[model samples]
Target: MPHCLMCTRYNRKCPGPIDAPLLFVDTSSYPSGKKPRAKKPSPPATSFDVARRFEDGRGIHGSGNLSEEMAMVWSVDISPRHVWGDAFFQNLVAFFCAEGRHVLGAVRRTPSWLHALPRMAATPPPSAARNSSVVRANEALGLALRATSAAFSSLETRSTSLLHHAYGLYGDSLRSQGRVLQERGDKGENLYMVMTSIMLSMFESVVATTGEGFASHNIACAKMIDKALEQASTGPAKGRGNNPGAGGPSPMIVNVFFHVRIQLCFVYLTTSDDRIRNDPIMDRVLLEACGWEKRRLPLNMQIITPFARLMKLQSHADYEQLAMPPTEFEHEKADFVKAKEEVDELCADICDSCPRSCYNIAYPPFSTFPKIKLNVFGFFSCQQYCTSARDGQFHHARYVSDLSRAKFVVAALL
Candidate 1:
């Protein structure tokens, strides 16, 4: 009953039948009791990482007309002369427009974490005197952006040159970071400095080594965000709590936290914590600080919290099954199945709701462009979900978000 009641009408399988709950197939016993690594398939351009660009063709197979990628410029928002007055920072802006924006935000579509970076990067120049702290923060942020671009390109394309470049840029960013904290550890430039740490940490998580540290140790930026909120509280003199989220919730701050939530959620999912294992409903101080009191709160409860609960359970179960000998897996297998079912069911109900209930993604009532263009009133069966993206079925962000989360739910169910 929790699944779409009209799935058969749409020529699809029901998402899942409650009577037949999905369970994990333990393959740990194969290959010397060591779980063999599953090779990840490369993501295609249409759905994700939409562009594979080589900024510098040194020691790499050049692509078709990378000139378009390089041509992403914003001549409108801020004066070209100011550009926050940092070259590396300027490149960071271009990188986001060219590749980084499409990579995460366009694919996930869950309130883009990409919104805050360029805006923060594109602020007006600080005074002519140039506050040392602000200057150092800008330089570090720009270097980190350059480093991030190189790191991702190298890993995605297996380019040795980009990898080497990423390493050098990372070191430069790191050296600048020391100066940033030592000068003004608690003052302004908190957001930019924090964003710099996040980009660098991402490079560390994926590029620096294997990616172990990014999960466990990359939480400093989140804490730094909390510090940013603290700094924002004290106004000029009175220092009354001027809530950013109070009036309408500053979009910039809200965007910052939405992005922060992604990292925090990621860390929570990957790292082992006994407390979160018992309780997945975290305080999520960052979201609160970002003022997710209205629709955003509902969105998180419906979307984020449930999925995270499912993932944390899955992560722990994976550790237990993989770490222990395959022979001992059966002892805990039943318990894992029970817990996974509850979480999976919750995510399914929230994300994959009936399309008719939403903005009716067809021609007449909802011709708001990018229609689902459902073929004669197709319905999403609660039991059946297709991972492949249809030509016109995004129906804007909600449908896309729901469909993607459902895939993870189904994957977990299996």
Candidate 2:
């Protein structure tokens, strides 16, 4: 496979930053089936302005400016030392930039656009060397996916604990208006904000830690929810033995969001292409590492089955305005409870079965856990941006309650 030496960026100023060159070594100038005669190098001036002179045209893919067919070939053409080493790749890029080495031009432009991009010329049977290159490329994909999967598992555990704590505190405030901060709306809105914040942080981390090709914001969100139950095993919250406001924890709300996030992640992963999504080892790893297959809702379609129903219900409730047609809030709440329990059980199984090496919930570490703040800014932000209100007139004033006796449940298992 040939590797693309240059990656074309979408630039408005010049058509491209680099160019592909066309060179011809006449067949008559060399001996047939014998030692070929050396040809003189292209002039330095020709090479010097390669990027500027090359014709800038769309590749066969139409969408990508560069030829998608060159994905494998370009990678192969580039030295592995440069591919694997940051310093080497940086220096190599700089050297290429300085010399203005452009892409080798199309061998011959066939009548059809399909033949415009580069392809392997007819060659003899494959050798050991050819097989080794393929093995290395696949190996790189495996390592990147493996790290991404592991990181997601870690985030799941942390985020789940955060959801549980948020709901637990909300319940306490609801029961006795005087318990915790004297505001119900404030507490509920804050809880929602924290959950959203946790999700954002988890997704941001995925983009940061996973290498370029394999990283995705959605994948990180799914992993955070699927692995949340693991945090429960760490232990219960402290100073709760004598605290009357320490309400019994409810997994209902946490489970709803957790499952929703997980399903979304799986959908994106299923549709992803072979470079990142089509890793041969991913399904096996998911099965053994997380017991995903047994619990998953069949093909990707099954995963969204619940959401399909939810959307329908929301439509009937919000749009139809029909009498006795829409599902009641209690019924919707009950279904959410059922889904939450299932997710909880599945998460527990994953935690129990996961290998010590494969699973690391302690990632992001205790130090990275977000600090809880009770300022008015939290309330305003939640109402203004995080939660949807019935109108600008609607307010979350119920969250403002007394915290004197309310027990502080650590937001997450960490």
Candidate 3:
């Protein structure tokens, strides 16, 4: 049998000759002795061929194959370096080392966020990595860190782009985490997820654009902390020792505990939302985690505990003034005064025991901003309590003046 057109062109054996004769024929001018040869159809263009043609500056008119190539690019695990390049990564790392770490490090003494930095810096890019989880987490962290660094430096264009990228990675990380949780059924904790959540939460808090979203992230951090604590408490090595840091929580956990507490407090103070402020479980967990029962609280806790108490007092005063009867007002007022005095005494005691310069050496490396803001909020809370005790009948002029002073201090701190 004669070879078919396709096999003849490729020099392969043909099963059989073409079955049908050509439909159009020039019979009058046909060759006398030889049969006409069928024209060979061109082989289908492959992905590589199309890509090469496009790269060579040829116009690709086929949308279907181009669409498929574009889809594959998105579907694959593209690295941050691929999208933003090595220069961007290097600049981001430099920015992170100089400012981003310190900005987040100021939130807690233990430097939990810093724990992942070295690993991330050392790890190969996502395209070369075998573990998807680590890659996703690192991508989220890079985006968040870069976004925060850009925001702090007042780079609007860079910050906006990074913020958008960070949100996209954040969604991917969440979906990846959800799938893991479903498969594992909560048998173990996903530390990478926790770390990414913390970074994203810090990003949200620093950006200050998503107030409610930041609060929700804080809540998620709190839940993660709780689960971690429970795991630690029920570990195989339970009751190993009495010393708090001996067999107690790791530095990361400690930092996370404080970070969650401080953010929640700040959220409540700024927004006055009771959901986080009045969370009894969070309050109890924090107390235990900080080791108040052991009389060995960290320095940050020492400064924050009094403010937390004052916040509680403010919440109580609001409730009493709004809901309680006139007959019960006097007792609530006295309690409020007592709480204010206690906070005053606590501040006085801290100031007396620690020199003014020593105050800056406290845990979380109390920079001027946090130190002054802490005092501003503390004193302002006390002033509000005093005004409330006077049946909301404060001298408007003087109150406004004091508030202006406090606002100025806060502005300077910010």
Candidate 4:
């Protein structure tokens, strides 16, 4: 029901249902034994060392103009001052162009194209299974999908916020253009529609990718579910397989979990899925295991509260809402800016939890928080009494205390 812009119309494109089953596979378990030994350290190599081997052949593999560019660039000893400064001047000139103005805001939004995010999967897929490659590929794919999903979630929020900001900027620009502020019909609406449309398109792309990922995970999990069921049924056990349903809710649990995953995946399949947007309700199962901590007072429900808030703000931005009165607009603008700050914090948190796979696809060191030592295990205070000779002071203290207590009790009794 918590729909994104693209998910409003493109409901059928959700891959979550198909990807639902894959979450159940116990990929963690295989060849159970003592932990594997750490590999010995290898010698370090530099970029120059590696680059030397591929120097001549570099960037020449493409079909056409690649060779020409390579030949031209390498043929001349281009001065740094000439090439680098010229390139900068070229960009400056291009920025002022009519066509460049259109994409400048969008391009400027992401200055760095690829970033390295910290990945969760430290271990490779299990080796003992015959379907090791399939399993490994699936795991890798799932990680990628999850990372994408997280990014989409983050992007959708920012996109919405941007739309809102653009609308405000359009209104301000209109005021400068000698347009009456009180008039209902303004160019802001048209500009907003165009910007909102782009945001919607982005959401559409995200949904398609998410759906594909979910479907892949689901197909793999379905096979696993079937296999798991067969093993439970045909395999010899102490008790008969009379009650197949009582597989400790193993297969069913997995089925349900991934099924929910699919539902969530597909839920955002349409921007108009009012179920997610208008009075959206979350199942208890989802609200709990979705990796968020429960709070006491304000009764915060989401696993990642800041991220959830960011998404909520994005949702508002994504949808078509009425233009507020100037006074209300100023208040909403402040709220929107606050949401943007919160979004930055949320993005930072997501980068922390799931590193390097963020917008830049490269891990930013500042994204990670400084580590503080937490005593997960509480401390215990032990009162120790050392005896001078075998059982001297300690024994005497104990005996005297007992004697005093006993005497007091006797006197009270008397």
- lDDT values of the candidates? 0.47, 0.29, 0.50, 0.30
**Candidate 2 on 38-105: residue-level lDDT in tens?**
89887653321331222111112224445677666442223212222342123322321222122121
Candidates 2 and 4 compared by TM-score, better number: 2
Instruction: Give the candidate order by descending lDDT.
Output: 3, 1, 4, 2
List, residue by residue over 262-310, the lDDT tens digit for candidate 1: 5666555544666433432234442243433333243333344434433
Q: Write the per-residue lDDT of candidate 3 for residues 194-277, one digit (tens) a residue.
A: 665666665565566658777777777677777766666557543344433445567666666666766666665565566766
1 against 4, candidate with superior lDDT: 1
> What is the full ranking by TM-score, best candidate first?
3, 1, 2, 4
Model 2: CA > 4 A from native: 1-325, 328-334, 339-370, 373-414
**Deviation from truth (RMSD, Å), model 3:** 11.3
Best by TM-score: 3
Clashing pairs in 3: none
Stretches of candidate 3 off by over 4 Å are 1-112, 118-155, 158-163, 185-190, 206-208, 234-246, 272-274, 285-294, 316-352, 355-414
Best by lDDT: 3
